[model samples]
Target chain A: MHQKIGERFDGRVLDGGAPDGMQTFLVEPDLIVEVCRFLKEDPELRFDFLADVCGVDHYPEENRFEVVYHLYSIPFIMRARLKCRAGDPPKVPTVTGVWRTANWHERETYDMYGIQFDGHPDLRRIYMWEEFEGFPMRKDFPLKGYKDAYNPFGEDIDAGGRDD
Target chain B: MTDVTILTENKKPGGGSKEVLLNLGPQHPSTHGVLRLVLEMKGEIVSRIDPFIGYLHRGTEKLAEDFTYTQIFPLTDRLDYVCPPSNNLGYAMAVEKLLGIEAPIRAQYIRVMMAELARISGHLLITGALPMDLGAMTVLLYTMREREMVMDLLEMISGVRMHTSFCRVGGVREDLPEGFTERVAEFCKVFPQRIADYERLIAKNRVFLKRTKDVGVISPELAIDMGLSGPNLRASGVDWDIRRDSPYEIYDRLDFNVIVRDGGDCYGRWDCRMEEMRESTRIIEQCMRDMPEGPFQVDLPQVAFPVDKELLQRSMETQIHHFELSAYGFKVPKGEVYVAIEAPKGELGYYIISDGSEKPFRMKVRAPSFVNLQALLGGATNMNYLADVIAMLGSLDPVLAEVDK
Candidate 1:
């Protein structure tokens, strides 16, 4: 499938091989929608299902954020992982045109890692409230999280403990 | 601030339909867990739905980053709280895949049995709850009684009813207790008749059929587009079950029919689940009959603790291995893998990235409920009555924990 895709889209999509037998492809952010459309539209490889979209925050790296798309070809029963570096502000073009289900998964990636889907229809925080503090899924974000009255560290310490 | 539509079909000279805003907040019982929907309604027919989720988000993905591979097992249980074994097995298989090892043959059969049993338990809830959502009360009572049998079986096997973190990275925590298979065989013997009783109660009932037969109809294209899985996808007549299509574990060895119905409505979803439960019983019986006799987990002391408890007390090397495994869990090799199991709800997956560390660098749960619930916005529920929304939700079977996670 990667060869079939690589032959058509020439150097636009590069194979990211792993020890595990998961078929992975690293796509350029700008040409992702094109590649995804090609992958879905091709008669032999109908990767219709967008299984999931998630963000990986690689702190201090040049390309800070990586957005991973898990796609499944239902007709052929093959799976592919398309990843693109959503560089500092973490913006990647939406594939909602290819598969409508990317809507909520994109919203969730935005909510968790602050990555932006370029053409998402109704992009909003699907999980956290609008007024929440920071992207919790980022590597720099503290695991203890912000302390509130309802979620006060769970300790009977001084009330003056600073919020991270 | 919201766009409103007029019901032109019932238009009178001046006004036949007035748009109303209904805030079915988190408190609505039929919302299942904490799902808030902003429904744009013209009288009773809903035009558009804007659902507000995340009330139950616990940052499991973020939390998993700080926990070890073994510690992450309990967290997966909470995603699909109905059938936790499937989550456990999915995670276990993912870690094993990364390590490039397989759990012993006996363990694979046992894990499959557990997953199928969890599927039955999960299907049992929707079988009862979907009807209870539509105003029938007795089905839930009868189904709960049967669910207790599953719970009892789980307790007998894993010592827990709900969150049976029985599965470990290499394999299961322990082997089945004596007489467990006999009780399971008895369940397989009696469950088919109980399914018949359920069909008598509601499958043929006129009111139940009327409420669900054509309501919330999902076309095969829309279901696949919106990423519906498990029984929901099968209910729409798309024959794409991961168990059959992509065999994980010993599923290829086991023989059972994948239930598919062309109804593509709430009734079809329910009917699919009922047929699936019967298939699950068949699966369990076959797994037990051909059950292999060998070590449950692989012989990797670093990955999993030894099965022999006496070795920890008696042998010095065993003690050190146990101590290291307990103090700090095993370090997985530097790689990433995504393992998805056909969970009762759908494809429950865990994508784990290991930076050659004790804890996962990044872990993302591909929850089925979250994607399946997105189909509600695909116009199936649009033009549906406000009450049909509940029926649709029940049919979709989106557990809010999995959705919001």
Candidate 2:
């Protein structure tokens, strides 16, 4: 299916390989929406289900954020993973116009990783509080959060505790 | 906003009224879990529903970054608390895919059995809860009684009722207990009669029909467009089930019918789940009849925990290997895979990315309830009465844990 897609898009595939029986392709971010549109519309490769859309932060990499889309073709009984990258304040075209499920998924990605989805209808924080600072999923973000930040319980509970 | 304008434009000139902002949940019992539905209501009719989720979010995906593949299984158990085994299986399959290994055939059969059992218990709870939400208290009591039996069976095998982290990456935590098959068979024998009892109460009841027959109708095209999977999509006449379509685990070998309906309404959804429970019983019976005797987990000592204490004491190599595997965890090849299974609610998928590290680089759970809850936005609640929204929500059966995962 990746080869077929590659031929149809004139080798738009930046990288292609089967890792652990999962067919994955790295494609240009600009062509992702178009490629997805084709994948859904094409009769031979009707990847109808937008299974998931998530962002991965590759810290220190030039293009740090990679947006991954998992597509499931019901008719063909096949699955494909589409990968694309963006830099700081990462932005990628939203596929919501192609699949409505992308709306929430893109919002979730934006909320967690701070990756902006271009043209998304409602691109607000889906999980975290709207006023929360920083993307918690990013590699650089501390797991316990910043020490000097506001503590809702009034004081740092750990301050009085004995050190192990 | 667009919907409001359209409603006003289409309304009778004298019938135009002020739209009321009604907050349905985040506290209401019918909303199921900590789900908040901000409904734009015109009198009793709901014009739009804006679902405010995440009150239950614990950032399980973010937490997975620090946990090893083996340690991550328990987290999956928390996603869909109703059917933890299904979540465990989906996560296990994704990690196993990355490691390029398969659980032994006996383990696969056992997985099918456990998943089917989970499906039954899950459906029973949903079936019971929906009717109870609609004022049928008897159904909940009856279903809870039956559910207790299923829970006991799960506890017998996994020693835990709700969040049974029974499934491991290579296989199950342990093999089936003695006479477990017979107990399941006994449950299967009496379960159909219980289904009949449920049908008697709600199948043709005028009140049940009145509330659910035509409410929350999701057209086939709209359902597919929204990416609805599992019984919800099947009820909408999509004829797609990951078990039958993709044939995961030993589902292909098992003989069972994928229950589908053409109504595309709340009743259709209810019927699909009810019939599916019967099909699940059938699958479990067949699995038991064709049960094979062999090792449950694969012999990957490096990947699986070294459970054999005797072997660890005797073999120095085994002891060191177990220590290394336990300390550093197993290294997976740098790649990503999305593996989904037909969970009780819908397609429970695990999207995992490994950077040739002991811990997962990124883990995303394609929670069924989270995705299916979008159906409400897909016009499932549009133009319906505020009262009907409860029935619609009950039919959708969104487990807040899975929804807000």
Candidate 3:
């Protein structure tokens, strides 16, 4: 299936070597929507289920973020991962038009990694507050959260806490 | 934003009939846990439903990055708190895949047994609670009573009723306690009667049928496109089940039918879960009969913790191996894998990326509740009566913890 998809797309599909038995493809961010549509519409390769969409932030890498998509083809009984790199304030075309479930997944990706989906219907923070300052999932973000933004409910709430 | 604005442009020409915006929850009992729905109502019917989640978000994915693979099991437990063992199994399988090791056959059978029990417990809650939400109070009491039996089995095995982090990377934490199989057999024997009781109460009741029969209809195509899984997807007449389609553990050896209903409504969803509980019982019975006798966990000194403390003290090599494994977790090869199991609610998947470190580089959970809940926006709730919205929400069975994870 990977070879067939690769041959079909020819120039668009970059051969991403299989890692940990996962058939991965690195496609250009611009071609993702088209590629996804092909994966869904093609009779032989009907990758119908968009299992998940998530983002990974590689702090020191040039292309800071990678949007990972897990697609499962029920008919074919095959699974593949599509990955595309995006720069800071990462922008990728939304696949919501292809898979409706992408609406929430893309929003979640946007919320956690600050990756903007270009054509998403309602792209906003799905997990964090709308006015949340920085992408919490980014490696650069501190695990304890921003100190300046911290406002405890009250001193009484912290009174019974362990000092250590 | 444009959608919200369009929805609020209420006044029609001539006589003004304005649309009223109603906030359903974040606290309302019917919305489940911390899920707030902004309903655009034109009179009594809901025009648009904007579901706002994230109230239960604990950033489990982000938190997994800072913890070792072994330490992340407890975190997975909290994703779908109702079925923690299922979540644990999914995560453990992903990590085990990364590490390139398989658990023993006995351990696999035990995992199957535990997962099926978790499925039954989760379904019992949904089957009972959804009817209760629709005003069948007796169903809740009956279902809770039965669910307690399954909880007792869990508590006996893992020593925890809810978050049974019993599954480890290579296998289960410990072997099934003495007479565990007998207790399971007893539950399996009595479960059918309880199910029949539930069926008698609501399955044919005229009021129950009226409320759920044609409400929240999701066509097969829409259900698939929306990535609905487990019973919700099955209710739409989609014959895709990870247990049967993509067999994991000992599911391939187990004989049980996948319950599917074509109604694609609240009743269909409810029926599918009820039937699935019966199927789960069958699977548990088969597991008990066919369970192999061997080591419960694999003998990977580096990956699996030594079960016997006496061996560590008796042998120098064993002590050093245990010390090293405890002090520093095992490293996985630099790669990634996405392993999913047919969780009680739906497809609970763990996508793990290992950068040759003890801790995962990135962990993404494909929570079924999160995806299945999207069906509400896809078409399930649009133009439906406000009352039907609760029935639809109940049918979808969204666990806010899984959604917000």
Candidate 4:
């Protein structure tokens, strides 16, 4: 089924049968939005679900934050993924209009990695507090940010305690 | 910020004019962990709610980046915390995909047994806790008792009751202990009847029905659109299960029903999870019957560790391979992979990218709890009262630890 869909879109059968089944693709990054529309609405490939949207920060190299999407076609029992690198304040066309689920996911990706999804309905931080600085998920972001003490459990403790 | 319930409930008595701000937890009983919800209340109705998370961000993902594929097992146990075996399985399956290896038949069966037991444990928590949120503490206690048995079974196998890092990248760390099967069988036999007892306790109880039925309603269309998975999606009448659809490990060969309900409400969700526990028992019994004997871990020299010190000390080749593998780690081919499983919460997935390095270039978790957490405001707003907000929260089952991670 992936092969047929891949062929129709003039996309290569990148994975699975080709010893690379783990990462399958159907469209190039430039044509991603259109390909996603087809995948979501096409009669044969009704992948009405947007399972996840995340950004991978490739540090050490500039201009490399790839936004990946995982889509599932319920009826056909097939899955496909799309990847796009957002350079600078990096932006990808929003899929929130297609999948409401993308709303929070895109926000999270933006909040964590500072990868913006252009035209996202409410592209605000959903997990982190409003005044928190920097994208915590970025490779460069200090693990503890700027907190005096790292208390994941929210216990009250002085910062001078033994550091593990 | 005033409690949403307080404002909503006191609106008429306060002449519908008072504005209140109340904070709910980082310590509240029903808020589920250290989550702070600042609610603006007009009497007893919540005008707006601002949720502040990150009280449990342990930087597990960041920590995963520094650890080897084999070393991340203990970290995965801490993510969901409630269902560590499922986490172990998801991460192991992702690593297996990268390694291009599958577990042995016996290993797969054992994975199934442990995962299903974890599922039952998770369901018991949600079931009992949801009821407890609605003022049924006794039912919660009963559910915990059953959960304790499941945890005991896990402890017997892995030496840790809750966060057992038994699952390994290639397969499992150790084989099932003697009489482990018998203990699982005993739990399986006793569980269904206990589940029935739980059902009798609240299934048709008027208050439970009143609190849950038609409350926190999410339609099938909305459920799918919102990326909900597992029993939450199943409860909404979508017959989508990763085990059936995607078929990871030995789940393809296993026979079990995908439970669904037409009504996508709290009650429906409860019913689906209840049915799932029963279905899980069936899978466990089948696994016990079909369990086979074979090597537990993959046979790849570069991937798996030396079984004993004898091999490591005596064999020069083994030592070299171990040193090389441990220092450089086993290299996964250059590519990307997303392997998802029907975690107790929903479709738990691991999206990994490899540049042919031992360490993953990028690792993104497709956590169902995080995605499902979005629907809370949409589902709870205007449809239910302030008290129903807690019930609605109970329904969404967001683990802040996972969400903030």
Candidate 1's TM-score: 0.95
Each prediction's RMSD over C-alphas, in Å, is: 3.6, 4.8, 4.8, 4.7
Question: Candidate 4 residues A1-164, lDDT tens each?
Answer: 56556676654423334234634553344566776777799888799989898888887577767787888889888777776667665767888778888888888888888877878877888667676656767776655454434445432234423221
Off by over 4 Å in 2: A148-164, B1-16, B381-383
The TM-score, computed over Cα atoms with residue i paired to residue i, of candidate 3 is: 0.94
lDDT per residue as tens, model 2, A1-164: 76678688888675567765668788787898998999899998899888989888898688789999988887788888888887555889989999998989998998888898899999999888888867778887756654555655433435533211
lDDT (0 to 1) per candidate = 0.87, 0.86, 0.89, 0.80
> Candidate 3: which pairs clash?
none
**In terms of lDDT, which candidate is strongest?**
3
The true-versus-predicted C-alpha distance at residue B101 of model 2, in Å, is 1.3
Ranking by DockQ: 1, 3, 2, 4
**lDDT per residue, candidate 3, B1-405, as tens digits?**
544455456544632367778887888888889999999887667888899999999999999999988899999999999989999999989998988899999999999999999998999988988988888888989999999999999999999999999999999999999988789889999999999999998899888888899888999988998999999999999998999988999899999999999989999999999999999999999999999899989898888878787897788988887777778777888888999999999999899888998899999999999999998884763327888988999999999999998
**lDDT (10s digit) by residue, model 1, range B64-162:** 988988999999899889889998999999989988899999999999999999998988988999999899999999999999999999999999999
Task: Give lDDT for model 1.
Answer: 0.87
Query: What's the distance in Å from true for residue B56, model 4?
Result: 1.3
Off by over 4 Å in 4: A1-19, A22-32, A142-164, B1-22, B40-42, B47-50, B325-328, B379-382
Residue A114 lDDT, candidate 1, scale 0-100: 85
What TM-score against the true chain A does chain A of each candidate get? 0.88, 0.87, 0.87, 0.76
List the candidate numbers ranked by lDDT, top first: 3, 1, 2, 4
Better of 1 and 2 by lDDT: 1
Per-residue lDDT of model 2, residues B339-383, tens digit only: 899999998888888999999988989998999999888566332
TM-score of candidate 4 relative to the true fold: 0.90
Model 1 pairs in collision? none
